[model samples]
Target: MKKLSIVTLLLIVSASLFAQGVPEDVAASAASRPAAIVASTSWTAAFADLGGLDDVPFIAPANLIHPPEYEIIVGDVLKINNADYFIYAGYERMMQSMGSSIKKDEASMIKINTNNSIENVREQASLIAAVMGTQAESSKRVAQYVQVVEDGARKVREQGLDQLKVYCHSMQVFLAKDLGLSVAGTFGPGPVTAAQIAEVAKGGYDLIIDNIHNPIAKPFLEVSPTTKVVVWRNFPDRGGRDSLAEMVGENIEVLLQ
Candidate 1:
């Protein structure tokens, strides 16, 4: 019985050693196996510009200033705001909501009307950008353009209608380019007659300036609320000088009572 027990213990020890040796042998065999040869991929080679093995065509940056199929006046809209201006037919409804006294003169009336027109232009512009899948980029670019217009308007607030005309003309040129409109003439009074305004309204440019500055210099800045038309008025200097610097070295002096 003792010899049989001793024999059984020896068999168990041999079995344990064999188990351990089998794993070590397997590990050694795995270690001796050849390593995988991985070829490094060049990412730049995939682009068309890079003479890489990849056959992918490189995409060039788009020109926002002159986008294809961008019409300045399509279907009669001035194409200022993101959308078309509401026709004068809808003007009454918009005016009613303003709760402000309507001006009697053509200038005041045009100001109010033009303000509304600009709002519609911005709406249309936004709609176009959204549809083109470039809304995020266009919005950023247009906002900068709007800020520039506001800055220029502020500078010309106290100036006379003549100065304002020049300012507005400059602003119009800047905005037209930013909005991808045709690089047309500056915002001077053109021969846009009342008859033309009515005709344009049928398509979209409903608001008319009516040659207030000049029948020829018909300078008007089209805007939407997003277009940021800031009008600075009520400057301290009666002659429309808002700054002390403007007051100095001036041939014209206003004696405040």
Candidate 2:
């Protein structure tokens, strides 16, 4: 009678376990998908500062404001940092329109704020690194950049560059902030007028950070011959340090001379 009871109990337990769910293999097969992240152009500078290409797995054209039109995978992730894609085609609306998975709130996604201070830049690198699961490698890479910026600031202060005030147009502000330089004024990256030069110089700025797109250094310098002028390249070169950083470092060297 005891032997019969043991056999019946074994059969009951087997049925209970099987009733809970399908086999592991079946579940995994149904959910087969690889996660991908699409970073926008505004955050590309943050990614560039992070310096771990293989880890992040980004697509081409680092500064593209909108990604190329493509099929939206239900499970794929998009990194939108205050860009216009959401406005042009709403995130939820676009997902629904695509007839894929209905997207939910990105509680899992990381965020970087709108502050453009040098400290903010470093923080953005760390945040992006942590999210991508490469914090250690990314931190090491970012440390080098941090050192470059710190050294630039130190050199500037040592050379008494605080006495030199500059007017940087558009994107050159990032370079200016990193070097601990003061911006007396600013303007567009477009063409400059003699009147605008007089207006900016009227504030008694000591230097002019010329726009990379416009070759108005000569024109601006002509207007204010007493004030020094330097070109601020907005992009990295083929084989060199940051054009922005290089400009700061070169000016420091020139100051020492």
Highest lDDT scorer: 2
For residue 108, give model 1's deviation from the true position in Å: 39
How big is the positional error of residue 11 in model 1, measured in Å on the Cα after superposition? 99
- Cα lDDT tens digits for candidate 2, 1-257: 96455445544544454356667996686457433444322234334336333323222232322232323332232233211112111222223323322122354333444233457656765766655566777667666666767887887788888668877775567667677788877766567776786786565778777654345556666566787766644322321223223434564454334
Off by over 4 Å in 1: 1-118, 158-257
Residue 113 shift from truth in candidate 2, angstroms:
8.6
Query: What is the number of backbone collisions in each predicted candidate, taken in the order shown?
Result: 25, 0
- The models' CA-based lDDT, in order, is 0.27, 0.50
Best TM-score among the predictions, by candidate number: 2
The TM-score values for the models, in the order shown, are 0.22, 0.53
Worst 10 residues of 1 by lDDT: 38-47
